[model samples]
Target: MKNIYTLFICLFLASFTNAQDKFLTKNGTITFFSKSPMENIEAENNQVLSIVATKTGQMAISILMKSFMFEKALMQEHFNENYVESDTYPKATFKGRILSFDKITATESATKVKGELTIHGKTKEIVIEAQAKRTDDAIVMSGSFFIDLADFGIEIPSVVKNNIAKKIEVSFNFDHKPYKK
Candidate 1:
């Protein structure tokens, strides 16, 4: 009986070690664009972390608010300090599932991704169109979505309201590899 129990435990652990059904990445990229008449703001961060369950079509992504880099140092500072309140909210995250997981293959496929995005301590449901290419070695997923600053509890100063757009465009590229034990 003890041997049978040990066998059951070993099988359970071995099942989790299989990497083919899961994919993960540590250095995905996320970019945000805010275009206004006064100025066009653009920032990119390559330190995103993401994971995907191929069988379940479930995915999650995390990005550090402070990691986003802007062309101007002042813009970066203002983004973190005033806009996003990076001190209070250090990270932004998204948790959702890919709609057409089975359709993902070595060829690129278009699909809709639905998930909840959290930023600046607020969360909102979002659906966006995405392109995905799955190869034997990796899965690449890319998408763009628009968000309203007010929806995420982010406020722009009235003095520079024209410098920022009320709706920001956010895009991401994630290349995930099979998880290994």
Candidate 2:
């Protein structure tokens, strides 16, 4: 996801220049779980790209739909080809700002971030609760939220309707370091 990093850096750089005002992570982690009566599906993607603008407490994240690694190959194939249609819509993105921008410090605290989240070609405005910590050299954020499939217009076939949960639990962790030239 070098291109994602480059693209995000360019987007953020175009607006600001101070390295300390920007924090970046090329290897953030995101995981999703779908619990069903018949089966439980889980996948993890460690190649998440994220950028945080400390000056404004603005954050942006990008995840490739196909980057998720499932335990079963068939599940991954079905997820890409049928569920998410990764070829048609390859990326899920979030652009948001921390509510208590000035309160973030070395001590972690419960925080609220509001922004637009887009997946499968659908965009929804959401507010997510997260624990945020900021220090001189690093900023860390972690949180979990649930999303309804219908909101994204992701349809599950009747045949496999019972195999997947209607609501998926998504979790994310991003550790950002100070940017430099």
Candidate 3:
């Protein structure tokens, strides 16, 4: 029927338009490093989920705390059970908007992204400087930032006080392809 054909056409167009307005990636990378007088520690997680809304320059990211792998198995175990308490706080999240986002092109540009970062059940407002690029098919973002452990109520025990740094350096990268349903 003519009505059925029109309805199908409308649905197709809607999806097509939506694909252009949003980008997503399931395997983004997030790494963190801590330096102390005793030693340096690092961990990486590749199972990060991120989304970008091209229309509003808004972005959201979700990272599983347990997904982070450390160089040593004991360190990883301590991180989940002693430090981050992964059982109680399983995920870290970020929701933010990109400033001067419309200026990004196929060429990488320095952009400011402001957002709320939630970790260990605590939230903090943060502004990060990131390199961002946008093309017809994809959006790429990479950046490094520092976070204070005390801000999130993650207390370091005195037994290993010299083993961890107060501030941790975090790096992230996400290449998002156009989202399609």
Name the candidate that leads on TM-score: 2
lDDT of each prediction vs. the true structure? 0.85, 0.92, 0.88
TM-score of 2: 0.96
lDDT of 2: 0.92
Off by over 4 Å in 2: none
Model 3 lDDT tens row, 13-86? 35435766888887899999999999899999998888788887888887889999999999999999999999
Off by over 4 Å in 3: 1-17
Pairs of residues clashing in candidate 2: none
Better by lDDT, candidate 3 or 2: 2
Clashing pairs in 1: none
Ranking by TM-score: 2, 3, 1
Q: How do the residues 1-181 of candidate 1 rate in per-residue lDDT, one tens digit apiece?
A: 3353344334433544456777878789999999999989999998887878777788877788999999999999999999899989988888788998888889898988899999999999999899999987899999898999999989888999999999999999999998776
TM-score computed on alpha carbons, candidate 3: 0.90
TM-scores of all candidate predictions against the true structure:
0.89, 0.96, 0.90
Worst 10 residues of 2 by lDDT: 1-10
- Sorted on lDDT, best first, the list reads 2, 3, 1
Tell me, by lDDT, which candidate is best: 2
